[model samples]
Target: MSPALHRRLPLLATAAVLVGLYASGGLLYDGFLSGRVALNLLADNAALGLTAVGLTLVIFSGGIDLSVGAVVGFTSIFTATLVERHGVHPALAAAAALAVGGALGAGMGALIHWFRQPPFLITLAGMFLMRGGAYWISTESVGLTHPLYNRLAAYELPLGGRLGLPVTSLVLLAALALGGIIAHYTRFGRNLLALGGSESSALLMGVPLAGTRIAVYALSSLAATVAGLVLALYTGSGNPTFGLGLELDAIAVVVIGGTLLRGGRGHLLGTLLGLLVFGVIQTALTFDGRLSAQWGRIIVGALLLAFILVQRLLHERLGRRRDPIHTV
Candidate 1:
């Protein structure tokens, strides 16, 4: 394989795995191939998709944000409390949550850059702070009965027959499309990839290191906040407990999507396929009533391992062929 093709092998593998899972599900379950079920998979995992997409950008820049899940949880409860308790408009509440998330992300990024700190430590502290702040706001779940929420909860864009796309799913698809464009076609995206592949090389090439690092984290937090909003819309309520450990899920899906966990080459399209793989496992387990949820976890774990190994091999191959001056 060419060096470029080697970079894309994991993405191809992910697509093949998704197709196999869908085929197996169709064979095993009565309604597995239905359009509704397919769309439901997307709808059910919209928040997760959003989070993973955001994390994708960060990972592409050779960074990790452990605070994504906490941000989601905080945004959900923070928005809900504003709408329910403080009589704040849902739109306004959402804006506030996004602002807070972006600020937190930028702050973390600045610390990582200016203080020469590791992203892991800075983001870990951020995770604890946000989670604790969420608990401080409300220990209990806050229900949302806003008219806007009601309308959104009930709204659906019908395709044909019994098939319809929910708002959350629509958002997920839109974000995926836009994310693909941004990741591949934009200068910022190139800078991010370069940074992830090798930061020293990125700086040597005059890629604005400080701005890219700070902006990527801010963008990731923004995505996470949007995910929290989607989750709130999906569940019609928000709890401080929402999105517990979801950062790990986002990371897993990104990795499974063929994005190198070490940073550098990957695609948002792969992340979508990875999320589908995740949904397929959950849906298949649901179809197979005899098996417990633990089985789903086991299956996911196995697939995650397989993908990681594939990535490792690809990395070795690329390392051998890569020019010393151009790491990406």
Candidate 2:
């Protein structure tokens, strides 16, 4: 296999599954076989894809972030609440959400750096805090009726005729492009990979280790905030509990995209492929309505486990350094 194809082996397999689903979609619902479904697929994957992009960076830096689901939850709820209760401008509300998300990320980064606690524990605490905070903001789900939010959320640019690209999707794609540039061209990007590879050595080599890791988390939060806003707009409502299991999905997408879960290795293209696979699976599952969404989770978990096992076996065969965490 060529380098690019080898790198995206998992995604390529997922694409085959997507084609299978599309074929199966015809048998279940003729509507699902339409171009509309394809449009919806892109729309549905946009927010998840954006969040996964940010997460790919954090994972690449050798850290796990559990607070992302909560952060997206919090930001979504906050956006809707502010529009309904305070009449905040959509632009200003968006800015506030991003700033708060960044602050939360910075806090978690500080905790990990200063206390020497594993990120798992710190972000777990963050998850609860943000989830509860979402409830505190609104005990009930809220939908947007504001003229501004409605206009912005539903706005579409003419891509051709009946087919059009949504403003939300366009903005999300723009964010993805910006993230790709940051990941490949910047000093911060190099530092993130170097730090994950060997923090001690990276520091000794003057890679600005602390700042890079801290910023990576912050960027993750910022991306989550952006997704949250788009979600509120598209759904015309906020579900504080909506992203309950999304962090796992994001992590799975990162890994499936060809990014290593253990960190120090990953790319944006891998994440994009991962999102495509996830979208295809969900689309296929929806076509078979008799199957529960719960089954989707089970399948996702199985896939994650299988990929992890493959990595471990590869490492063993290569005689690379073994991880102490999962050896037993």
Candidate 3:
């Protein structure tokens, strides 16, 4: 393959796998290929899609944020409590949640950059802190009966008969669009990719390392907050345990989307496809009543391992090709 084609092969493979999975599902189940199922994929996985989008940015910047799921849990409970007990408007409460998430992300980023701390450690601490904070605020699920949430839950943009996209899905698409632009067209995005490729090279090239790192984390947290709001709307309540294990899911989606875990390369569109693949798997399991839901995890784990191995092989091949003398 030509160099350009070789570089794009992974993304093409990811897209093909997604399409093939959907096709397989359609072949296996009647009515699985309908517009309703298509729309439901987006609707059901909107929060996850949004979270993956944010995680894509962080990964592209050569960083990871394990605190994303915890932030989602925190935001959900915090927003619900604000609207439920404090008589705060849902809009304002949602804004507050976003602010808290952004602040938390910024703090973590600062620690990672200023103190030269590991992203994993800082984010793990953040995860514990946010999850703990949610429990501290309320140990139980807080039901949200706010008019604003009710209206949002009911709102749908009709596509045709029995197939309309939910408000939450639209919100997710909007975020994806914005994230796409940032990843592809912005200076920050370019700097992020450069940093991911080689932090020392990026610094020598005059990329704003500190600001980019902090911004990436903040953006990730902001996305988590948005997902949290959507989760609240979906469930009509917020629990301290909301979004449990979602961070792993988001990371899996990113990796499955063909983004390198070490982070020099990734695409927003790939992440979306990855999320679709995840949704398709779950939906397929649901359609097959005989199969246990627990099987989904096993399948996902297997796929994740396969993808990681592929990445490792590709990385080794590229390294050899780039340094032929060293390889010899």
When sorted by lDDT, best at the front, the candidate numbers are 1, 3, 2
Query: What TM-score does candidate 1 get on C-alpha atoms?
Result: 0.97
Q: Candidates' lDDT values, in order? A: 0.93, 0.79, 0.90
Better of 2 and 3 by lDDT: 3
Taking the tens digit of each residue's C-alpha lDDT, what string does model 1 give over 1-328?
Answer: 6767767889999999999999999999999998889999999999999999999999999999999999999999999999999999999999999999999999999999889999999999999999999999999999999999999989999998978898999999888887888899999999999999888999999999999999999999999999999999999999999999899889999999999878888988899999999999999999999999899878888999999988888777777676654454
State the displacement of the C-alpha of residue 169, model 3, in Å, after optimal TM-score superposition: 0.4
Q: Model 1, stretches more than 4 Å misplaced?
A: 324-328
* Candidates 1 and 2, the one with greater lDDT: 1
Instruction: List residue ranges in candidate 3 displaced over 4 A.
Output: 323-328
lDDT of 3 at 319: 67
User: After superposition, which runs of candidate 2 have C-alpha atoms over 4 Å from their true positions?
Assistant: 1-34, 315-328
Q: What are the per-residue Cα lDDT tens digits for candidate 3 across 1-328?
A: 8877776666787788889989999999999998888888988998888889999999998899999899889998999999999999998998899889999999999999999999999999999999999999999999999888888899999877877778889999999999999998999999999999889989999999999999999999999999999999988999899888899999999999989989888788888888988999999999988999999999899889988888778777876877585455
Error of 1 at 307 (Å): 0.8
Better model by TM-score: candidate 2 vs candidate 3:
3
- The candidate 3 region of ten consecutive residues with least summed lDDT is 319-328
Q: Candidate 2, TM-score vs. the true structure?
A: 0.88
Model 3 lDDT at residue 98: 88
